[model samples]
Target: MTYTQTTPDHDAGTPGDVGDVVRLLEPDGSRLADAELDPWIADLSPHELRALHRDMVLTRRLDAEGVALQRQGQLALWAPCRGQEAVQIGTAHALAPGDFVFPSYREHGVLLARGARPEGFMLAWRGEEHSGYDHTTINAAPPQIIIGAQTLHATGWAMGAQRDGSDDVAVAYFGDGATSQGDVNEAMVFASTFRAPVVFVCSNNQWAISEPVTVQTKYPLAGRAPGFGIPSLRIDGNDVLACVAAMRWALDRARRGDGPAFLEAVTYRMGPHTTSDDPTRYRTDDEVERWARRDPIARFEAYLCAEGVLDDSALAEVAAAADALAAEVRAACIGATTRAPETVFDHVYAESHAPLAQQRAEYVEYLAGFAAEEAR
Candidate 1:
C-alpha cells in the first residue's frame, strides 16, 4: 500500500496509489510551542486521546511488572517494552478488527490491545511451550521469539489474503534489531513481488541488545523496504497521533487494493534487552534517564491533562484498573493448566513415531514401577 503520513501542516496522502507524508503531531507536549498541534488535537476526539494515553500507561506498568516477575523467578526471561508503548499501542488501536497482526517478542502492548491474556505468555517463560495464543480465535499470529521470523509468516498470510479475495490487511511488528536478519529482507521481497496487503512496522528503538542502531544501518531503516518495490515511511514513534495516523493511512489503502507498506516507527528502547542482560554494563544510567523524560506514557498524559479530559478521578481509576489487571494476570499466571507429561512427543510428526511413543510408554511404566516399589 502506498502511504503518506498525516501532519498538522500537511494533508494526508493524495489518492491514486501515491506516497504519503510522515507526520509529527504535538512534538514535545508542552515543551515545543508548535501552533500546529492545537488543530491536530482538535481533530482528535477527547475519547481517542484519553484511550491512547491510558493504554500506553497501562502497558508500561505491565512491562515493569513483567521484569519484576522475572527477577522473582516466576519467569525465565522478560522483554521490557518500556519506551515503545506509544508506537505499538497506537498503531494497534488504529487497525480494524479484520486486520491481522504478526508481532515480535516485545509487542506486549500490541497483544494487550488485541485482547490477548497475559496468562498465555507465562507458559513460555515458565519452561513450557511458546505459542502465546491460538491464532484462530483472534486476528493475531502467535508470538514469534525468533526475531524477524514473523515477517515471513506475515508475508505468507498476506498472500493468502490476496488469493482468498479478502481486502483485510496484515501487519508485522518488528524492531530495528530484526531488520538486520535475512528473514526480514526476504519478507520484503516476498510481499513486494506479490503486492500483498501487508504493513511491515519496524519499531526502531535505536538499540539492538548492546549495539546502537548506528551499527545496524547507516541509512534509515524505512528506506530498506522501498528498494524491494514497497512503499514506506518513517514516523516519530513516540507520538501516538502520528503512529495512529500512519497506520490508518496504510490500512485504508491496503483495504482499497493497494500493495503492502513498510513503516518505521522511530522510537527508543529504554530498558535492558531482557531480564538476563544488565544494561548498566554497557549503557549509561544517564541515557536511560534521558529517555525517561520522554516517556510515552508521561508525554501522552501531559497532553491529556492539558486537554482537561484526564481528571484526578480518571487518573485514579486508571491506576486502580491497571493494578487490578496486574493482579488478575498474576493469579492466572500462578495457576495455568499443567501440560500433559507426554505432550511433547504427541505432535512430533504426522503420526506419532513408534519409537518415541515406545519411549514415552516405557517412561510411564518406569514411574509405575517406582510407585509399586514404594508400596512394597
Candidate 2:
C-alpha cells in the first residue's frame, strides 16, 4: 500500500506510510484494497455514492463562494477548506441526528452537511451574528474560533450525555495547530477520565497558520491520544470512503461508552488559512501542486465514474446543483443584514447582572450624546 511520488520532496516515512494511514482510494482515482475498511462502506449503493459526491461538490461550491465573498469585502474573513471536503462531508454524514458536532471556524462543509441554512451560515462570516444558526436546532455548536476551546465544550457535552444515559455522541473538530493548546489537552484528559462519549477529530492539514505540523509534535498527532487512554486512528482525509468508514467506526465506539476516540485526518488546506493569510510567503508552488493531484472531489468522482455509478448526465447534474447552491449562497450572503448595536447586550447574561446593566445604560447614553450634539 505504499504510494510513490514523482518528487523527492515527498517523504516516504510516517506521513506517507500507508500502514498507518487508512486509505480506501488512491490518488489515481482507483480503489485501494482495504479489507478492514471495506465492510464499513460495503452497504453503500450507487445512489448513495452519488449523494456523497453531490454533498462534496456542494460543500466545495459553498466554500468557494465564501472565499469569493471575503475577497469582495462582503465577509470579514473566510476559512477555506478547499482540499478537505471529503473529511468534513463524509464524517458529518455518518453522524446521527441526535449527535452533536463542535467544529472549528473552517468547517463549512460540516455545517452544510448538517443542514444549516446558507443565510444563517453566512451570518457569522459576514460579522452580522455571534453564531450562524441556533445550535440546538442542528444538534451542533457554532463554529469555535478560540483555538481548541471547542474541545472542552464537546467534552463537557459528552459528559452530560453520559450522565443522562443517552447514546448521543459529541464530536469536536479542530486543526493540527490546536493540538499545541493546553485547552485541547485538558479536554482530552477529561474525556478519557470520564469515559465521555466524544470523538476528537484533528484535521491535520499540514500547516497550522504558518507552522508545519512537525513543529507542533515529534510523533504522529494520532499517537498523542493513546497516552490519555483513548484509542486513535490515522486516516487519509482525502479519501471519502475512508473518512466515512473511520467516522462510523469512531462514532460506534463513542456510542458504546468506550470513552473517547481521536482521529487525525491527514489532508491539506489548498487555500490560505483564511482570506487574510498569504500562504505564498511560506509554502512552495510545488507542494501545493502535489496535493492538488489528490483533490478529494476529483478522486471521489473518478471512483464513482470507474464504478459505473456516475456518467456524463450525472456529472452535469452535480455541477448544476453546485452552481445553484453557489448562486443561492451568494444571494443570501449579499442580502444578510446586521443587528443593531443595542442587541449585543441582550445575550450577555442568563440573569440580570448589575455591572452589565450599568454598561448598557452608559452605552445608550453615550450614543444619545451624539444625537444631542448634532442638534447644535
Candidate 3:
C-alpha cells in the first residue's frame, strides 16, 4: 500500500503501488543504471566504496557490542540497528560538514558515521552522562530520548541557519512511530510556513516497539509531508545506494532554499526494540527469516565482490577492522569510571545558578552528616 489513504488530492504517486520505493541495487547484488541517482554517487572511487562498506560493518559491530554489554549488565539499555545500517550510513555520508543532525536515540550508526568516539558514544547507554560528545565538534545533536521532539529542534536550528545566510542544512532523524506524534506534525507546519532548510528522515522499520506500522498510519509516512506543502520520497531503506542518492537530492533542495523535504526509508528491525524487549512475543520467526534473506550488508558485499572492488584479502581486512572496533567499544564500556552521586550537579549549568548551588550544597551536607553518624 502507498503511505496514506488516497483522496482525489493524493499527489504522492500511483495509488496501489508502494509509493515510489527508489532503488539502485537489486537484491541479487546487481547495480542498475539510473540517470538521476548516478551523478550523486559518481564521485565515489572504488576505495571510497570499500570504505563505506567498512563503515557499515563497523557500525553494525558497535551495535552488536552495545547489545552484548547491556545483556551483561554494563549498560542500562541498548538499542539495536542490526537491519538498518545501510540507511543510516548512507544518509550520514551524504551530509556536508557544516550540516547539523538531530537524531533519535537508536541512531548509533549515525553517531559513528559522524565521527563520535566509540568510548564516549556508549556513555549515555551506560547511564554515565546526559550526552556522549560535544555537539559543536560533531555538528550533530545528542540523540533525543523524547519521541519526536528533535524535529522541532531541527526546524528551529534550520531557521537560525537561514537567518544567518549560511548554506548549512539541518536534518531530523526519527522512527515510524514518531511521525504520528503531534510534535512532529507541528514541526512540519512550522518548517513549511517558514521555509526552513531542514530534512525530515523517517526510518520506517516496520515495527515501533510492539505495534506495527499499520497501527500508526493507513498510508505511507511520506504522504503526510505533502499536506504541509513539502516534497517527499519513499525509498527502499535496504538499498544503501538509494539512500545516498535520496539524501543528496533532499539536502540539495534544502540548501538551494527550496524549503524542507521528507524521506521515508522502508526497512525492517531484525532485533528487538531494545535489549529489554523480546521479538518472539509479537513477531514470527518466518517473517524475520524473510527479511534476513534481504540483508543489506550481504547484498552490498556481493555487489562489491562482483565489481572486483573486494577480494578475500580486502574482506578479511574489513572483518578484522570491525572486530577491533568492537573490542575498543567493549573495553571502553567495561573500563568506564562511574561518577560520584554529587558529581551529577557538576555540568548542569555553564555558570553557577544560585538555586542549584544551594541544592548541591545542602545535598553534600546531608551526605556528610550520614557519614558522620555511620562513623559513630
> Better model by lDDT, 1 or 3?
3
Give the TM-score comparing model 2 with the true structure, all chains together.
Answer: 0.93
Deviating ranges (above 4 Å) for candidate 2 = 1-20, 350-355, 370-376
User: Which residue pairs collide in model 2, if any?
Assistant: none
Off by over 4 Å in 3: 1-20, 365-376
Q: State the lDDT of candidate 1 residue by residue for 1-376, as single tens digits.
A: 2333222112332211113324454434653333432233346678787787778878877787788878877878888988999899989988878889999889889988888777766666665664656666678987788989999998899899999999888999998889899999999888888888989999888788888887776656666666787777677677777677778767876777778888888777888888888888877888777667767777777767786979999999889878987886677667667686666565456687778889889888877897899999
Lowest lDDT 10-residue stretch of candidate 1: 9-18
Candidate 3 lDDT: 0.87
Candidate 1 colliding pairs: 1-259, 1-260, 3-20, 4-20, 4-21, 5-20, 5-21
lDDT of all the models against the reference?
A: 0.76, 0.87, 0.87
TM-score of each: 0.85, 0.93, 0.93
Worst 10 residues of 2 by lDDT: 1-10
- Name the lDDT value of residue 264 in candidate 3: 88
